[model samples]
Target: MVAARITVNGKETPISPAAPHTTVLDFLRERGLTGTKEGCAEGECGACSILVARPGVNKPTDWVAVNACLVPVAALDGQEVVTSEGLATAGEPGKPSTLHPVQEEMAVRGGSQCGYCTPGFVCSMAAEYYRPDRCAHADADGHTDAEHGPNGFDLHALSGNLCRCTGYRPIRDAAFAVGTPTEEDPLARRREQAPPAPAATEYTQDDSAFVRKSTLEETLRLLRERPDAVVVAGS
Candidate 1:
């Protein structure tokens, strides 16, 4: 079997060949990161959603919402990826030992009922907030969508995350109430940001290689060829 190196969360992990058809979800779970769920192994559901970072900076990296289940395992090599386990530490710099503003907001506003989909939504929101090129433009809010932009505090972040228990009202309020917490958590001031819009999905300066595969055989063939591939699999 071929081998490869991958940077998950903030650590480097070495992976093995999967006979060509392993999903990123399986890889992550096997590696002990159960945060990347696998409700629907297909691209239709965002359960297996995780963050994959291609090197980029002030010029944000191109962040594409990809299906981990659909993406072959050999496509990820030398890539910087973030899973739910790493979001608290790797999210938008400046905050340490704290949950990402998005996730924290969801908790505060009662946005998390089942909490199964919270991680996916948080990562997705972080991508939206950090993508430099994906500007929301000056809507009713004076400036473009700031991390604390006016429209930035909306329930749409929950769209990627599913909620079967609590209705969307609390989730919406949570997304809208971020970074503006009450006396309960005073430090929230520095953490809050605005809601992200559509164009805000793709980050600038981000580089990622997208490899499409239909079956495990093709994926294994690719892995055998590119031992250093970065594969994101399903659980």
Candidate 2:
């Protein structure tokens, strides 16, 4: 079984005796973090969207949205993950927590209906909100133009998330309503202080092994060592 420690929502979680193929959705739900739902398990629905930050690389900011149902828990070793539950800022004693700007816009704009898909949408939108290219456009009123294509907000970001009960109008409104993030935003601070990307690591569970090589030389060496191993690419 794969055993490793990973950071979740800024806290370290020790995964002991976990199956190598255990999905991230299953692992999170088993820990009572049900905010990330399992919709199509095949990774097409985007209902299990979550933000993942690795040790290295910084193209689309530090974190990127991913489908939890299609990701193996072992793949998150030494990485950081943020679910819908982590979107809100912590509240003071006896005070209510403050929702992220994306969550607040979604609620105020009636973007959520049945709430089953809200979490996934929130996570995906949060990633887009933190994108570096998000500040390219904004009206003087500080709102994105929904009528225009490729404005400050990209509606295509939500293409993966599906909502059966609600229309896309309100959701699009919420997307446009998210103004340019201020320096006070938690994610903005994270982006400002993100660490460099991490090198690839290998993990093993029973007879199964998962390896992520940092360099082509290392990958070739491993392949030469295990010539009989099955090689599969892309989740």
TM-score for all predictions? Answer: 0.61, 0.84
lDDT computed for candidate 2: 0.80
How well does candidate 1 match the true structure in TM-score terms? 0.61
Tens digits of lDDT, candidate 1, 16-102 = 534344567787888788877777676655767777654344433434344576665545644556776775634356655677666
Model 1 off-target regions past 4 Å?
Answer: 1-3, 55-60, 90-96, 133-160, 179-235
lDDT (Cα, tens digit) per residue for candidate 2, span 181-234? 787876666775654354375777687877778788988999999998766455
Worst 10 residues of 1 by lDDT: 195-204
Q: In angstroms, what RMSD does candidate 1 have relative to the true structure?
A: 10.8
Output the lDDT of residue 172, model 1.
Answer: 62
Worst window of 10 by summed lDDT in candidate 2: 54-63
**Using TM-score as the measure, which candidate wins?**
2
lDDT of each: 0.56, 0.80
